[model samples]
Target: MQGFWDCMSLWKLLLKGKKGCHVSSCRVRRLMKKKLPQAWRKSAVDLEDCLKQERSLYKQAKHTYAAQWRKDFLTVQTKDAKKHQWKSRKARDRFFRLQQMKQREEARHRCCAQSKGSTGDLQAIQIEEHLSDGTTSLRTITDRRLVEDGCMQETRHAMIKHERRHSPVHLQVSKDDHVYFWPRNPENKGSKPHGLHNGHFKAAIQSPSIAYCDALFRNIPLTTGFVPLQWQNLMNFAIKKKPGDFRLSKMRTIQLMNSEAQANNKKAGRAAMQFAEAHSLIPDGQCGSCKRHQAIDLALSKQLVWDLLILQRRAAGWISNDAKSCFDWVAIVTMLLFGLTWHVLSSMFNMLSFATRRICTGFGDSKRSFCPPSAVPFQGCGQGNGAAPHLDLGDTVHHSGEDICASVQAAATLWLGGIRATGGAINPEKSFWWLIDFEWDARNGQWRFCRKCSAAPEFDLKIPGLYSDIEPLRRLEPDDSERTLGVMLSPLENHNAQEAQLVSKGLGVPHLFGKQVYKHLEMILRHMLGGTKPGAYMDANLQAHQLETGTSFGLLQQDYQNTSILASDTWLKRVWKELESLDMYVAFDSPALSLRWHHDALLIDLFIDLEVDQDDLLWLNWCRMFLQVATVSDITTADGRYIRQCIWNGFRDDTYRTPYNWPRTVRPGRPYWELWQRTLSRALLPSHGQHHPLLQPLGHWHDNFESWNWLWSPTVGLFHREGAAWTHLALAGSSTISRRYAPSGSHSGTDSLQ
Candidate 1:
């Protein structure tokens, strides 16, 4: 019996020794596997000899490990080659796309020019003829030899004007308005030159040695408040205004100063803007050069006001006035006086004033003519001056009185009188006043123009310098849109006009729809595939579809259909295989098989619905979703119940209330399910509160709870919880929480519960 025990122990010891030997051999094999490939790459060797040595040491079959190693190496090589090929293909496609875009832009420009006719050329001829006429000619000479003499005379006059002015009040430069001699970007070519081009100055400023010399030159003028004679001289060019009649009056002049002078002018302009803003000198209504407000903001506000007036069945009047040669006619002395009153730094104003101009016609340099300060009625603020727009005077008046026309006329008269008092005059021909009113047409179910309530009266505006006799204000028709401060104002709905304008710019509805579809699909596919391979595939498919169907809408529809089928089938097969692997019985014909496919289909469909749907009440869907989720009562899970309570608490504590009265304003024509689906898709964004910690867990159960109470609740049930969950999961990841929607307290509470 003792001998038997000893033999058993010896057998166990032998087994242990074999196991250790196996482990040590594995460790050595792993090291060789890692090192051999690197060694083989570095130096050429006999593969047969290496395999023979490996076989002798490990007692392995011939070519077993070597064959596997070679397979892996070839696999890596093939993958690298394919990756390089894809990169080159992507770059090639990008180049072609850009070239095509450039061609489209050029074609659009040509088409626009053809449609507009030769008005620009005709206006140019008229301006030249007008300027050349002896009676009204601005040219002082016709000979090239007399150019130097004219320039000398102009310089003498500028010096005289400077000497005659009263001494300026000195003010210290603020840190906010400190002037920096920063170099202009090298890419900005074709700069209009006055003796020295901007490029030369830009290059000089980039060099340390030359930059020091330029700084000294710039500092001398800033210190003394005296611009050099050459810098004061300007070259003027005439440009025809678009949508204007072929006449000299429709032409505008742009002046180009020396590059160094321009740099100083830019600095002065920036300082002047800062000073004006600090003092609140500019009125809120003057949106042209203000930083706080934009011209678009004023336009949108006016549009909103008009809509409100229409809704209330009220009438309003507006008087819009434009100054003739607004920048050209601004009085230098008057600007200086205002600057003093406003406490602006006198050196900045001095740098802007005391300039002479020489007109450059298409033929030559205005026949050696120079416009001196004494010859021009009001000098200094030219069209190209950096601070010219701020100095140019303009005004708009809105009146809601019963007698709107009379109110507008009174306002216009007072405003024009004030403007004339300041040595500025309004162009009577360009100024206009029009009444706006709209009535609901029950037959068409939309607002229509009220001819009787809205009338643009032809009343004479009696202002002294503007007109010798009373001249009638031109009435703008209801259909006609007016451009004011770079914003287009129309009596009709501006959105339609804006849409038409965007369409003209190649951003039509179909184009936008396709772009959005591509964007959403690319996002989903990228998440699913875990790479950019899906995006490349989708782009290739889109290009193919674009070729197959030339029309934009047709191409979008075809691409969407193809992508839906391909993505749905691919995801369905993947999910089915995964289920089968888990030993879950899901028949091919089972209803459960369609859940993922349906989710993907509905997701894309909802995206399309939002893009194309023009219903005014479409925005209310998000509010409906939030309200429904807040009032849900059937959630059984702890997290689900907590989410509901938190949502309810949010509604109770906050001022935001459910839009219960929306139905009274707009009766939705679509069914509740379709609306719910649309809302689910729209609210997928994290900003809409979809990424809350409580909401993230629900996404995992979306496939299981299709028939949940929320899905069927038309009034206050959580019937599309799964849809909302999936949407949130698809847009924002399943585990990711929205920092914006999830409060710190809620996140901590949820974490503790979990």
Candidate 2:
């Protein structure tokens, strides 16, 4: 037994020593005294000293091993990086080669198809010649050759004249000190380089060599006002407008330009844009290319006008015109004339006008055989030019009352003349006009479309250049909605009903009982747990807690114990049973008469006392309306809760205040919150039971203005102690707020009234 104890002590010391621990002689001696007899005490001290020596030797070996490991790791990393770089370069080369091969195949296919058709015609001619006399056949061939020679001579003469017209001297480029090379940040300009040499832009900023080369190439065209003939080469192709649409009219033509040409165009376009903006050449109605103006802005403006016209019971006309090939038909000569008239820089116009396009059908087509004349009298801005959109000319007109037809005719005539002057035309087939008028229908108890008062039955409006009569547009009845510029305009009465229907479908609840229960659950989750945390996080936590306890985090059990109403209700039991089968975590609060589902974070609080009957169906419609408003507001669950909190606080204390600790409280201003409160109060309070505090209208709260003495103001400094500063504050603040909320006012309406 004594020997066994001694061996265990030795084994423990050996293990500790191997782990690089210093085994003290005194500590070993004390352990040995308890584990071994008095006879082994002296030997234990010697054993501890030996173990200490081994540990030091082991640590030295470890340090040497670690150093070697790090050295090898760095060497491997370098080799890997070199290998990756080589692979990337090889892949890029392969990609370019494949692209070239594909282009060659497409060109060959087109050539073969043309050749086959021509061969059939030639064979027929040869057969006819064989049947006819030899002399006549020879004479016919000779005549064809002579005509071809004359055509070639004419083409050569035309080329010479074109080259002379585009020469530097003709364009007036004599300045030697002109600095046309302005370096621009590619990132800021959103310039994405694509072509055979696109890789040059990848390291353009990092590598001085590439940047210098790009600058050198870009300067030549800007300085001389003559693009290099080779750079003018373009490949034209057609892409389908949609996946399965093969109609010729539905195809879009695309022109591909090299990276160098693209870069030059971008610089010239930016210059032109700046010039237009500085001169205010672009009209207010032209929102297509204007900064800070969007399609939605135009749509909202039109909608507002329509609404006003409808409200005033006035007849109005709307004309929608589309230009046929707006970018492609505008002549280069017209562009130059406009530029000169606008007093644009002579060099800029020279560069833009003189740059001719020679396009081929395929990228692999030979420049001499497939490409056309350098100066083909190009019309419109080439589709791919950056400055094309900025130069585009169009107009929108609005007129009301009896002179609507005359107004339309005059506007159309004026617009067409301007378009023709710019070498552009409108497509009458694609253009449409709408006659809008509303009248109160006593039979239907709502305002309805009055076609009789809107336009004459035999009215025929026409513009000379269009060569077709303008058609009256009608509202689509299939969907009960009319869409213009992607905004859906539905009848006022049906809009709310449609929203309610959509909400009912989304919840997947056909019965009033299920809907009522779900609504209560959604309310509690949105107002309580949803505000403090994200839906995903709360769902996961609740799910985990439910799984662990098998009782929905004690909520169900607590509800079962607290009240007999929920426990005894058969409908509530059925809902619970159905919920358990679903892939969701559900909890019920008997006191609040609320239920919550974990997955979607759906909480519905009936907002009724436990004694009140939960079977009422009258309030269900109002609940749906409130939910629809919240959804239409496009607010997240957390934001909805925060907005509700703001409203509740405002109603209770007559002061709207949100929790300072709330993460997103500072995002929405007082007006935004009040707007939401007003909207929600209108939606819920009108039909909802008066028992809940939220069912009462939230009147205007007292404006609790706090004086910020320490905060710095951009215009008035730390504190506005002077009268001049206060006056400036009043004017500037009002202007800023009005500007900020102008767009918001356009968006706020009865669109989500349901």
Candidate 3:
């Protein structure tokens, strides 16, 4: 029947005297209007050619026919012309679109079919095989056909309700329904996100007493949609038993199997880790010390916005923060939440800027691998098809030492591309944390530091006077097909674009080029022998891969797709700038750029600098690779392409923006610094003396400019004891020299002479 219709159409075309019907073979005639194409390349070319032919025909018809002839032509050939025009589209596209739609409909039908069995289905997916004292172990039947999104909203509500009911405690949440924080584990391999509360956070501090805990439990007010009673009892009993001092001293004992203790204790852990692979645990979370509390307080100083009006409104350009102390928890939470709240409200109003979807994965207290968005079924966060916005919680206040383990573990969710941030990033279960964004006023040189923070710098290993004249370096955008050892500029353009949209609380001059905002960052690659690049750098895909997945390009392809899954790609830019500003490669043989101290937030505010031990520097390259993958991130689009260039600058000469001046509380014993040092030591140190080459001089002998020792004590004082550790350092106090020689042995200056 369709062939007959096709023949009829062809007859109509022939009677109307179609011009392009010259091919005579039956097969050719049959396929003349078929317009079938195979590959993407062919389809693209065919589409272009078809458009051109159509244009030529239109032009020819306009001039070739008289007005009366044109009327007759239109009347005689209307249907044929329409059919031919439709045929101009490649058949492959029509087929592909039909296939895509079929796939979508099939997927939807499959979901509906599966959902039929999930709601009150009582399906025995995971059967509880072992019930240890504090743990419940289960083995689940693999049913790939189960659609996560269609698993019934009531099922989730039931889980939450059952868990809360068992506990018999809940805080009435404001109808605002806070957005949960969903940070990722390095790979999608660790524990998933879970809810956190008082005992949950305090476990890391001191074990709760039966009386205090019991009283606290009794007193915990119940609220709607909170943890159910069953899980509450499970948690209460598990934590009620005292676990001895697992403070900073417990860092070494990662796994727990106490043969000396009760069987109940063992069972509790089994239950927690075995509930589902998605379960993440929140160990005791408390500020272990006064200093830690202060640190946490400082990090979490930003204030939360009270209402949706100020909390949710995105602009087109120029989102700035100028208060000196405004970059606190409230600010970060505000930044994420305000953006997200606006997003949610926008969704409510049907006003999303683009076709972004809702994240719907439920992260539980288990391995971080299950930390996926609860909204989208397959892919989680980023605008692209892979992961989502890796919004990491960086506020000092949020870094409670005793609670970090708990917080990182319990509150860890997969916040794909900052999408699941309706209630702001902070778990609204408590009031101590907030994730907001602030700004830095470049023109006036002011920073919006967090308002509620009162903590002072915990450690300040001052190494004053540095490259004061290192001019401000604007991040240049990577040209097509070329990547280099400098700050990429597209980040800046994207940053500007995002600031306008309230997608980010950016620094620099945040401006939107179009609807998309570029990311602005600073970069400086080592660009030397033994470095990872040239090969790594030239592979534009590699750079993009790392920039997106926050992991190695090689690792990314093997592990996941759509790799923009890091917390903050901007941090990578900062590393690049530091290298460029220091001119790390060339030994300062000439009149050198001044050597001084730097105290950016990455240093003092976070205490990452004090942590690098002498042995860990060798793996610094690898460490950087890991950390960049873990921390920094960029924004891309749905089809796996960057919307704009991230502009990276090499140097910035702003006096107020002193990358050198540091906070005072960045000493060895400080919590974060110590933790980083320990991490570096563990990563770099070996049992045999065969340490990595970078590690050798972290303290004693290497000449790398960015070494822990060099960055900390850049210049050993001239007047100090002559034979001290500082004295043995290369060109100890010389501003222009970087050669190796023992301290001038001829010098006989005595301390008494001074």
Candidate 4:
């Protein structure tokens, strides 16, 4: 009975599978393996394959069901286009027509009033009479399309020149013909344009106003090197680097130069330290006691060593990266901290409402009639003990009363903090002034303008968030009548940055005096040449070199009729002829140039001009001949009469204006000519050095030995002084302007000249 049951079970299991064999359990496999190993193994493998196939079929059916559900339920609903269609074309046309009419009216109003409306609107209104884009009429559409296509097709339009000061169209039209703008079309042969003038037509000849020099005019190069290696040169070198090399050569060169600079700085630092020690600025073993000692230590510190190198290089006009090294990084960090400190100080000054002012009597009368009780002009601010506190950038002195002394002191402290934060206080020379009146209302902790004040309602000077009741703040006025201290900041006329920088680094001695001297000489020369008035010549002599080589010879315009040049008549004439022939120089006419004796500081009021050409031989001959002729006696004429050479006693540096006029006026004196004589003479005494006297505070020279020598030197030569040395003038003459005296014989001082 047991055998039959087992056989039946086996048969049942084998028959359970459809399309494949089935093994119900691993236990059955184990039993079969013990009884019939091979058969059991095969059946087990078949069962596993059947299971995998079933799983894949079930998965495929499930995905199909999900896809069908999504297709039916997740579809987006859209409205029909037919339902949203407009009911009628008439309504749409009406709406567009109304918009067009509104735009047209707005454009017309704008055109009449000259409002800053859109250009499209203006163009639309102008073209509306011929064609309207809003109109549904075929003619209107066709016209619009034709106009656009015509504009597109036209390759070029004839250019019509117009007067810069005149408008193309006039609003006050007298007729329909005048209502339109000047038509650009060539076919229109109507009345001439309203603003059209005969400017292009030839006019009657007229004489020029300003007289120019007859000598060759060479425009000087305005840029020059401040040092042996200028920053611009370095930049040029950097720009020439090969594109593919990643600028390695330029960078390497810079690095090498930087290293050399570092070494030099170290040497300088050592020398400076030794000098300080020798001067007793640094005590033995006490390194950080004195400011000098501290400075030395700071300079020598590894962090600052590179910074000093970079600073020195920059000052000498070398391009250098400030933050390219460790020193720069340290400096950046320090400056950042300093800047933060300033920001905090500025915030405090603004928050605390710190300010200073004056309150007292007037100049003309003790009674304050000139100034109202509520306010006063800047001139009538005060002249008493209660005047505004003396607050300046450097070590400040508070002039406030005891009651507000503490507040003023606090404010001063903040100001000092700001100065340190900004690296230093502003240069007194660079400070500007403006007229302003500050009001304070402690009650509201704010400032407001007084309605009765002379300033307009819009011209209030009150700064927001500041309050002070001690006194009203009166600032320096910009008005000519009220301005007391500084000139207003304005854009420089004909500004050239490169030229300005070059001029700044030029001539240690002041050049303005020389310019004045030149002007005097020119006037004298003109009077001697011809006693003619201005406007005697209308045109200038154009040189051949100028026409062909594009190099200008002589000024663009000159008045040669009034003055004449003789090739070999007088000494000046001969000198001028030779100089002009050699393309050297001849200047008795340049208003801003003056030749002077380098020795004894003797001024050569009139003589041959300098040859600034870069020729060693030419310069040598020039200086030799100039000096030879300058220091000699009068030349003997053909008729046995001595013709005194045109030479005058050199003017002093202080002599900006001359009292010696030619009895008769050739031209009206320069602005403030007479006034400058009286004012400048008293102000610029020898004892006063470069400083002006009590009357005027502005000084011509700084309080230094170099400045003193530059201003007061009586024996310095013109070529020897200032940047003339850079022109290779020092190669020829005794660096001094003076030469050894020659015995009486010929005009030239040298005996060698036969």
lDDT by residue (1-754, candidate 1, tens digit) is 2223333333333334444543343543344454432432321234344444543544342235657766888899888784334354435644664565456557777876887543321121111114444554445453333443454355435444553233433333332222234444332422344476766766665566676667666556665666577776667777788655546646777877666666655555655556565666666545566554556545544554454344333566656777766676665555442233222323334434555666777677754645442322234466776667666531122223334656666777787777766556776545665566554343333445555333443343344335333445545545456666554676564446555655566654556645644544444344235423333333333332222222222223333322222221122223333433444432111111122211122222333445534332222332232232222222213233123333322222222322221111122233533554345435332333433322223222333343332222223212123223411112222344541122112111212221
Distance (Å) between predicted and true CA of 746, model 2? 50
lDDT of 2 by residue, 1-754 (tens): 3334444566466556656789876766766666544534335456566556655655665667767867888899888784324344435644664565456557777876878642222222121123344443322332333434443344334433442211121111122211223233233222222234444454463555555665665566665545565554455556686678977667776555655565555555555555565665666555566565566545534543443343334455566667778877755443332232212222333333444334344354435524322222335555665566766651112223344656656776787777767556666544556555444443322335555334454555565333332333322221243444544443232355445655755756578556756754563365345342223333333332232212223333334322222221122233344444443445533222112211111111222221223322112212222232212111122212223433322322222222111100012234433443444444334433333233323233221212111123354322222221221122233564453211111121122211
How would you encode candidate 4's per-residue C-alpha lDDT over 52-104 as one tens digit per residue? 65556556655676577555554533332235345555346446645654565
Query: Considering every candidate listed, which one attains the maximal lDDT?
Result: 1
Candidate 1 structure, TM-score to reference: 0.41
Higher lDDT: candidate 2 or 3? 2
Winner of 2 and 4 under TM-score: 2
Candidate 3 global CA lDDT score: 0.26
Error of 3 at 38 (Å): 54
TM-score of each: 0.41, 0.38, 0.19, 0.13
Candidate 2 backbone clash number: 10
List where candidate 2 sits over 4 angstroms from the true fold.
1-195, 331-378, 393-403, 440-447, 452-454, 464-754
Error (Å) of candidate 4 at residue 100 is: 50
Off by over 4 Å in 1: 1-180, 185-194, 207-209, 243-248, 291-294, 331-356, 363-367, 373-380, 393-402, 437-449, 452-468, 477-479, 484-488, 494-754
